[model samples]
Target: MKILVTGANGYLGQGIVEELSQKSNVEVIATGRKVDRINVDVKKIPVDLFEVKDPYNYFGRPDVLLHLAWRDGFIHNSPAHIDDLPKHYSFLKK
Candidate 1:
């Protein structure tokens, strides 16, 4: 099964990817805004969820997508986070 995980570089995401990747039947496709910096042993795709046109174009067609990504300072609803809301909606529409 192909599994796509967004925010794959974050604290919880890293652990989730590690655990999921250990499954023999799972194919992990890890994505993050700074995926290049993520130190995971899996297929990594760097994507700014707020700027992508067609996510599938970059992420390929996966069997499932676990949306865990959030803009920086999301907890406090910073400017970037606020601006990302529309982008998030657009991505979801696609």
Candidate 2:
């Protein structure tokens, strides 16, 4: 099974990637703004969720897409947080 995980460099994302790596049947595609943070033996693609014009073209269609990447992470009620809403919608619509 092919799984595409966004924000693969984040705290929870890192753990998720590590756990998924142990599965023999899974092929992971780890994506984030910075690719160097991911040390797993998986396909790494640098993707800033809000900036990607065509996500499908960059990463292709995966069996499962784990959308964990977020802008202004963990910062509630901030301007950056508000800015993320539209981006999220755009991501889903695309």
List, residue by residue over 13-84, the lDDT tens digit for candidate 2: 888988898899999999889868777888988867777787766677778888888766777666876777
TM-score for each candidate, following the candidate numbering: 0.80, 0.86
Question: Cα RMSD (Å) per model?
Answer: 2.1, 1.6
Candidate 2 TM-score, true structure as reference: 0.86
Q: Which stretches of candidate 1 lie over 4 Å from their true place?
A: 73-81
Clashing pairs in 2: none
Model 2 segments beyond 4 Å from truth? none
lDDT of each: 0.80, 0.82
- Model 1 poorest 10 in a row by lDDT: 71-80
Q: Could you tell me the TM-score of candidate 1?
A: 0.80
